[model samples]
Each structure stands twice: as C-alpha cells, then as structure tokens.
Target: MRGKSSIEVSAKLKHSFLFPDEYLDWANETENNFYVESPLIYEVAFYNGIKALKPWETIEYIPVVLTEWKKVKLEIESKFEKRDAKGATLPMRVGIGLFLELLFWTNGQPVELNPIIPLESLKIKPVNITERFAFILARPNLFHSYKQLAELMVEMEKLYVKSIIVRK
Candidate 1:
C-alpha cells in the first residue's frame, strides 16, 4: 500500500469481513464494505455465517480498509492504547495483538467469552496472509507497549539496511 500506485490494481479487496463474537448467537449479513463506529468481534461474515453483534458502547469506528496481507502480525499480552478525555487519539503507547496461526483459521467464528480462548477468534483474509483486523478496544496501557515495539521495528529495519550496505 505504501509503494503501490493508486492506479495499480491487484486482487480486488474483500468487501466483507468476518467478525467473531461469542456473545452473538450467529452471523448476519449486510451490504459489503460496512464499518461499525466501534469494534464488533466478527468473522468475514460473507463466509463465517450471519448474525447481529452487541452495540459498541465505548468507541465509534468503522472498518478502515482491506489491506495487503503482510502488516498484520501480533503478539500476546495485556494491550493498551493512549487516548485523551472523551476517548480520542493522543500521543500514545500501543500494545501488540498476539497473532497465531491457530487464531487465523478459527473460521473467524465467535466463541463464548471464556478464559480458554486466549487469542482473537476470527480474521478477515482480504488479500494475502495478513487479514484486516478491526479491533475496537478500550485499553490505555497497551498503547505505550506498542509504541516501544514500533520503535523496535524501526531499529530493526535500519540495521537490516546497514547490513546490506556493508555487504555491498
């Protein structure tokens, strides 16, 4: 996405995403390419099944975009996001979503909220391996962790570059 041209095209983006929520009895369908003001745990419903989801109480957001499948990597732990009063964006730390291959294959189905399910249950496989994961959460501590992780990634990339130059 960062390098691709606007005119360039690839496999069309998957319009529908599966949101998995144990609270939901089943999956439901609407027009493709919809977003909720808040996060709804769902599957790529076009495939997962159909149902209604609990109304979001804390955040108002929509699915941002069906992205190329590479950026969505996750790790497990208490997550956080920084916000200001009224829950708006602020300079913040972010925690990581623990991603596993097992979670990726969950039929993007909903599971009852239980301690056993330690990972996100569903994923939207819009393009490549990385599916679009729209998370509407209300944690602040995780954000700082994410900030640190992001910084680590930057450093890794720089080292990778330096190594390439040395090799040359």
Candidate 2:
C-alpha cells in the first residue's frame, strides 16, 4: 500500500509542473519513506534557492566540476546546432531554463535577484556575486529566437568558464 501510494504521488509530480515550494513541501512530508526519493525534489528546491530542511549528509554531494561544465555545454550546443540544422522553430525557453538550473547547481553561495525578473528570457545576464557565484538578470521576452538564445548561452558559458578557472 505504501509503495503504491508513493508511486501515485511520484507520478503526479512528474506529470504536473509544480512550484519549487510545493515540491519541497511534498519532499519534506515523505523524506523518511524509503519508497519515495525525496532528495530529487530537494535538488529542485535547492536549485530554486530553497534550502532543504535536512541536508543529505549520507548522500555524496558531487559538486559541478570543469568536466561536467564542458559536458553540459557540449550537449546544449549540439542540441541547438541540430535544431538549427533541421530549421526547427521551437521556442528556446526550455533550453534557457535548463541552463539556469545547471548553473545553480554549481558550488557557490546562493545569490538573490529581483523577483520581478521573468524566469524565462531571451537574454540572461550573469552578475558575478562572488569569485565563483552569479545571479542571472533576465530580460523579459515571450520567446527567444535561435540566434539570441545561442548568444545568451555563449555568454553564460564564458561566465561559468571564468568561475571554474577561479576555483581551480
């Protein structure tokens, strides 16, 4: 019964887009349940600036390294390149969001930005908060053209590369 209930809850979460806070709350309630993996939701919360109530001390925390950054950059670049080659007109919002999500996972202190900034933007400017941390400033737009999104990704890559260099 417990396994079934947990599966249902997990399915619901996977199917619907919930705010980070909602996922955090669900994870907190089910953290002790072996059938439910709370750490995954905790990751989503952490990426969105909500610290988990109970840190996963037992779990190995793999901080993003230079190799990981390179992997992510190459993957994203390949995706966009393929899309461009196919002449697809798909919106780049999702790709941009993925970039930001990955950026937040980097080792650093969380930097707060104005709440007014739209989560998805054509141009996301990274403001270096510390030697290894940044807060993104997003210019509001309904959608991003391929060229604009590619440029933004390049800029973000430069910032991450600089931070990685400082960390080394």
Candidate 3:
C-alpha cells in the first residue's frame, strides 16, 4: 500500500508543473542523487515553503522588532525547531542560515537611532526558490548534480520572475 501511494505521488508530481521541466528532468536522472529522492519530496517541501510566502503575488518580509538580542534569538530558534519538526528539509535550513546571516550582517551597519530608542527593527526578506537553490549550490560537495540544479534554477527564475513582486 505504501509503495502504491508513493507511485501515485510520483505520477502526480511529474505532471504537476511545480518545478521546471529541466529541474524535474535532472532530479529524475539519477537514483542516487544526494537528498534528491525519486518522489522529490524535498523539492516539494521547499516549494511549499516558498508558496507559503505567496511569492507569486508579493514577497513578504518578516518584521521583527528588537527588544533584546538574546530574546529575539531564542524566539527564532524556537520557530526553527517547530519548522524542523515538520520537515528539516533544505528550505528550513536555508531559513536558519539566512537568520544567522542577518545577525552578522546587521552588526556592522551603523544605526543613527538613540541607544534607548523603542521599536527599532529589522526585516527578514524572503529568498526565492532560485536563491534557495543557489544557496544549496554553494555547497557543491553535498550534491553531485549541484551545477545542473543551479542552471535549472536560473531558467526557472526567468520564467517566473515577472509574476513576483518585492513588497516595500
């Protein structure tokens, strides 16, 4: 029964157009591709994450007001744990990676506000699927087909770029 369900999902995925044909072709080419399951569950998970962001309409930034650094860090960590529990896929890890980058990136930038200023905040921008795949490509050793994936993402980006809006 489990095998039947897996097969059914695979059939549906091939026709779903959730990802570009080039990407689907590359992912399906190898049986032992790193973290690239035949059913492409991880890719689907990543797509689902991006869809949650409503990218077709607008790319939303998660606004977080700063009170104390530690408190914000803890809250983010808790959210990460919850997301991980659902499925610790590439997208989830990319989110945590972006968070870490934000921490470091913000530290060097100068702020003109007074030290006691209230509600000073930072926005966490959403990374599109192509960007997320590029992030994964940075660690090429993890996936043998990383270069192909990167190329495919570029194509996918070109096709869908017009529909995506960057919200101010």
> Judged by lDDT, which candidate is best?
2
**C-alpha positional error of residue 107 in candidate 3 after TM-score superposition, expressed in Å:** 36
Poorly placed runs, candidate 1 (over 4 Å): 1-33, 41-113, 120-139, 148-168
**In candidate 3, what residue range of length 10 has the lowest lDDT sum?**
50-59
lDDT of each: 0.27, 0.36, 0.30
**How many residue pairs of model 3 clash at the backbone?**
0
- Per residue, candidate 3 scores C-alpha lDDT tens digits across 1-168 of 111111122322332122234242233323222231122333332342321111112122112211222343344345445644333233333332233222222322211112221112433222343355445434423332233333433333333333233311
Q: Per-residue CA lDDT of candidate 1, range 57-88, in tens?
A: 11111112111011322221211222322232
User: TM-scores of the models, in the given order?
Assistant: 0.25, 0.36, 0.19
Q: State the RMSD for candidate 3.
A: 17.9
Cα error of candidate 2 at position 159, Å:
1.6
Model 1 vs. true fold: TM: 0.25
